[model samples]
Target: MRSFHVSKPRVITVDKNPAYPVAIQQLKQKKKIPEGIQIRQVKYLNNIVEQDHRFIKKRVRSMLGFKSFDTATSILSGVEAMHMIKKEQIDLRD
Candidate 1:
């Protein structure tokens, strides 16, 4: 979150229910966050990320396990980089 140059970010978190107050309080003290930047809380919107993780985990499980740390890293890095690149392409197309 801090890596992105987004202020007043609308955070969409997921759990059985929304518990955004704790997260908002924690963010309040962070020096990097600017004042007056509203932090909006959203719940049950993280299913997409969770679903994506499920596919990646399935791929890992299919391998029985990673043979080496580097191989695992390479696979995941490629997956993430490709996902980002493709997402940007889609956004541009829109």
Candidate 2:
């Protein structure tokens, strides 16, 4: 996962997950990130993603459970589309 923080209106700090470490390591070793870019080894910051799981659980509960995988998938597909449409209206700016 990649995270970008905006300090000012323009300044950005991008933190890429280093769980594997190889990608960042290679980028640094090959100088792909360039000089003056600070690459700090950080602990896993998975709280945001973890917190979102509760919503999935809530959605599941809202469905009242499915008897079969196909039924679950069908319900999920429709629910996901509805959710996307609702969210896109709020998120997508023309």
Candidate 1 per-residue C-alpha lDDT over 1-94 given as tens digits, one digit per residue, 9 for 90 to 100: 5566755544534444445556656766786544555644445455666566765787778888888989999999887777777667435453
Error of 1 at 78 (Å): 1.6
RMSD of 2: 8.4
Off by over 4 Å in 2: 1-55, 89-94
- Local error of candidate 2 at 92, Å? 12
Q: For each candidate, what is the lDDT?
A: 0.64, 0.58
TM-score (all chains, Cα) for each model: 0.45, 0.37
Q: How well is each residue in 1-94 modelled by candidate 2, as lDDT tens digits? A: 2346623222122235544356655766897654445544435444444444555578889778788999888877777666667667446666
- The TM-score of candidate 2 is 0.37
